[model samples]
Structures are given as structure tokens and as C-alpha cells.
Target: MSKPYSVEQPERSAVDAMDGIVALEFGADWCGHCKAAQPLIQAALGAYPSVQHIKVEDGSGRKLGRSLRVKLWPTVVVLRQGQELARVVRPADEEEVRRALATAD
Candidate 1:
């Protein structure tokens, strides 16, 4: 089973300060695109056990989402040492997600 998006999100500053490779997946549980991408995201993430993945619940008035300018569902922003390396929005397949994750490698 896939994990549900968490409403308790870390501040953008905190995220920006994070160390190592991190995957910030911004989406909502009710979003179809988000749901469809879960498996692909998980499969790709499995190959990179060192990577930290944070599933964030996003919607209107969500500060983290707003600050990140997340306007779409299932935006996987891959970061390396707190800096953005790549992003894949609404990935169609595991390979797409893997490609985004590859940037941090």
C-alpha cells in the first residue's frame, strides 16, 4: 500500500536546509494524477534507498505548496543537498520518475 499525503508539511526554509538527496512529492490524496503516480514514484524511489522522500498534502492556502509554486498534482521535486536538481510533474511511467531521481545521483 502507498502512503497517504501528510498535511503536516515542513516549512520551505526547512526543506531548503535539508541535507542529501530528497524527493518532495507534492499532491493531494483525492487527486487522480497523484494516485496514479504513486506506484511509479515508489518503484523509482526503491532504487535509491539513500534518498529521502517526503509526501506532502497540498491544496489552497498551503504555505509550503504555495511557496514552492506547486500548481499541479504529483510534482516530484528532486533535490541534492537542499538544492533542486530535477523535477517531474505527473510522471507517466517509472522511467520518467527514475530519470528525475537520476539527477541527484
Candidate 2:
């Protein structure tokens, strides 16, 4: 796993040796979209035991989010072997996240 540029974020290489299901969520704590999708994300993640969930508190000076080109809240990027597999933005459907996770596994 490659080390993250910021200490507040997880290293991408942390999930490189796993089953290839890494979910990186970029959002601020006060963002409504982030809070709204929590339950759905949690529920969908329940079905994927191997998925690595990384919640990044993104904002000004957040390198990880900037590196990923995240421009909105609650952006979930599903990665496999340090490579991007799927991306969900402001998801309203739990199935959307589930489907993304399914791709990596």
C-alpha cells in the first residue's frame, strides 16, 4: 500500500493485499450528503466482509481527496490492487455501493 500524503487519511496500499475491495469515502463531517449516506453505506458494506472502508475527512488541504479529484461530498471510490474500479458520488441507492464493491471482489 502506498503511504498517503496526509496523516488524516489511510494509505492506499493498506488494501493492496486483500481480496481487492477497498472503499474510500471522501467527505467532511458536517456535509449533509455524507451523513445521509452513512446508513446506506454501512448497510451495503455489511454484505461485503472483505471490503476495506476508509472514511477521509476531506476539506481544504486534504491531499487524498485532491489527488482523487473529488469535488463533492460522500464520494466513494472503490479500488482494487491500488487501482480504481468504481466510484459513487452522493449515492441515493445502497445497491449502487453494493454493486461497486461487487466489482472489486
Candidate 3:
């Protein structure tokens, strides 16, 4: 049961993995939307425990989030080999998260 890690800069190997689902969760711990989405995100990703979930502490100073053009908290970016397949911001529906996961398969 690995949860997301609050790292400032994510590693290239983690992001650019040529295989498997890598979910970059950009958000702040204090954000309400981020907090609310956690449960749903977890549940949605529960089916795919192998998926790499990286919780980044995004803010004005977090360059990675800005580089990814993340405008909202709890922005989930599903990637494979560092290529973005899909993204969801402030997702209220579990389906959206599931959709992100499906991209890996």
C-alpha cells in the first residue's frame, strides 16, 4: 500500500518510464479540493496498485507543476514513458480517475 510522496522534483526515471502507469498528483496539502479528491483518487487507483502515484507538493515555487501547465490543485496527469496520455483537474467523478488509469493499459 504505497501512497503518494510529496517531492519537489520528480525523477526522470519515474516520469519517463516507458511502461506502466505513472500518475503525477500535483497539489498542496492544504488545498480543500486536493483533500477531497484524495479518497476518490485512491479508490479509483485501488484496482491498479501497480500504478506509480507521485504526490507532488505543487505551489508557485514548484516549477514542475508549472512546467506541466497545471492550473488547478489535485491535477492528475497519467503518463507512460514521460508522455502524457490524459489529465484531470479537480476531478469530482471517480470515472475520470479510472479513465486516467485505463490509459496505462
Candidate 4:
């Protein structure tokens, strides 16, 4: 909710080097599925305020998304100390996101 999906995406290396809890949200602003899930994502993220959320705009030729093997809109990849902890793609509700975030704990 604090930051919108940004076109200026970070390099895969930077993301992989991040420490602590990180939520990488891969999606395009124009994506309907991404738009629809914003509220749900926001609500779930609210509980994990310490988690770093980076909304990356994903599409063809986007190295970060490609490296992560993102094939759908709003793919939320939770990472702990630069390693993957959990992933939720096209989440249907806030619970799905919350559950994914819970893995960090």
C-alpha cells in the first residue's frame, strides 16, 4: 500500500543480497489481476510492518521476474536473508498472503 508497482525494478543480484524479510511483488500496473489483488496484498502486509516490500513491475524481458520464474500477475515471493522462504501466486485472498508471510517467523 505504501508503494505502487514500480517500473524501476531492482537487479536480481540486489534482491538476492537483501537481508531480513523481503516481499518481492512481481506484476505490471496494467495487469487486472495485479490491480484486483492490491487490497488483499496490502491488508496482509499490514501485519508484517517490518517486512520490506518491493513492488517490481514485471513483463517480458524483465530479468528479475524471469530469474524468479514468475509466470503470473501478482506473484509474491517472500525471502529471508536473500533466500526464498515462500511464494504465493495470484493469491485469492489475504489469508493466502498472510500464510506465506508467516513462514518468515
Candidate 5:
């Protein structure tokens, strides 16, 4: 359960192969919103067990966030077969997170 939520380091193949992937942009410990969204993201991942949940840091030196055009912290990007499906920027609560996940399908 806890294992799938593990962060996958930035790589081309890994990111490209995420068909039905849920990519989460989470910053370092200093980000308050990122921290706040962690639990909700975890729960969402738990519910969608088949979804590949990948966490990426949204701080300096992290190109992943910029590549994804993440303008806000704690951005949840959902993808289907490595394609951009839906996104939620700066989600406020678990319900929002759930809604985002629902839209991904």
C-alpha cells in the first residue's frame, strides 16, 4: 500500500510509461500546501490501486514540475497511458482530490 506511493525519481522511460498514471507535484518539507495534500493524495491512491501514483518535488532544480507546467504547489496531474488526462492545482481537501481522480477516469 505504502510502496506505490513512493516517489519515482525523474526519468524519461518511467514518466513516459505511465499509462493510467496519477502524477502528484509535491514540494519539500517547507511547502505547507504540499504537506496538507499528502494524506489526501495517499487516500486517493489507496482507492485507485491500479493507478500509478508518482510524486515529484516542485522546488528548484526539479524540472518535472516545470515540464508539467505546474503553476501551483500540490498539483495533481492525472494521465491515461502517459497522456495528460486531467489536473487539479492546489487542491483544498480530500473531496477535491477525489473529484480530480474521478475526472481522470
Candidate 6:
């Protein structure tokens, strides 16, 4: 079986492998939308497997989410060379994710 793409505890060095990044995020497992979005995040991410796909739980009181100005669960942010390309809040279609990734430069 292929390795599951989800990372429960990501290291800083690990994320550097991606020339671009897609962050699918929320605060915790208790969120219904967050649970639903996981599979979509995984499948959509396959198209850009070289892009770093990161799932961040926003409410560990970590500064990352705050810095990103996350205001909702299931937010997807695309970044290239560590710079923001696009952001979607609760996207319903995988195409939006794909489109965002494709736009990365």
C-alpha cells in the first residue's frame, strides 16, 4: 500500500522538499467539515505530489495559523517557493484546489 499522505507531526525539514506547498487546515478532529475535507485534500494533492501537502490543526494554540490569518476550518492555501499563491475557504470542488496549485509560480 502507498504511504498515507497525512502528517500528524510534521518537521520543518520535511516540508522543504516541496517546491510548492498546499496547506489544508483546521483546528481539530472534532470539526465535521475538517473530517470531510481530508479525503478530498489527499486525492486532489496527488496531481501535484511534488508539492508539499500539509494539514495543520489550527488550535493547538500554535502561532502558524494565527500568522496565516485563518478564520475558518477547511481552508486550503497554496504556496510556491514559500509564498502565497491562492487561498480558498471551504472549497466544494477539487478543481479549485487543482486550479490553485496550477497557478503557483
The TM-score values for the models, in the order shown, are 0.94, 0.83, 0.86, 0.94, 0.76, 0.72
Write the residue-wise lDDT of candidate 3 on 1-105 in tens digits: 235448657655546854677888988777889888988898998888998788888888667787789998889998887889899999998988998789778
lDDT of 1 by residue, 65-92 (tens): 8887889999999987667899899999
Better of 3 and 4 by lDDT: 4
Q: Which stretches of candidate 6 lie over 4 Å from their true place?
A: 1-19, 22-24
Off by over 4 Å in 3: 1-7, 11-14, 17-19
Point out where model 2 deviates above 4 Å. 1-7, 11-19
Instruction: After the best TM-score superposition of candidate 1, give how far the Cα of residue 14 lies from its true spot, in angstroms.
Output: 1.2
TM-score of 4: 0.94
Q: Each prediction's Cα lDDT score?
A: 0.90, 0.78, 0.82, 0.91, 0.67, 0.63
Determine which window of 10 residues in candidate 6 has minimal summed lDDT.
1-10
lDDT of 5: 0.67
In candidate 2, position 50 carries an lDDT of 77
- Write one digit per residue (lDDT tens) for candidate 2, span 7-100: 3765545545556567888877777788788888888888997787878888877777777889998899998777889999999989998888
TM-score of model 3 vs. true structure: 0.86
In model 5, which range of ten residues has the least summed lDDT? 1-10
Please give the lDDT score for candidate 3: 0.82
Candidate 6 residue lDDT tens string, 4-105: 224254443444345546554544566777666666666777888777666666664555665667788778777655566888777677787778777763
Candidate 4, which segments miss by more than 4 Å at Cα? none
- In candidate 5, what are the lDDT values of residues 1-105, reduced to their tens digit? 133223445664567666566555455555777777778778766777777666665656566766777777778888766677678877777777777777766
**Tens digits of per-residue lDDT for model 4, 1-105:** 346788998887888888889999998788889988999999999999999999998889998899989999989999986789999999999999999999999
Better of 4 and 6 by TM-score: 4
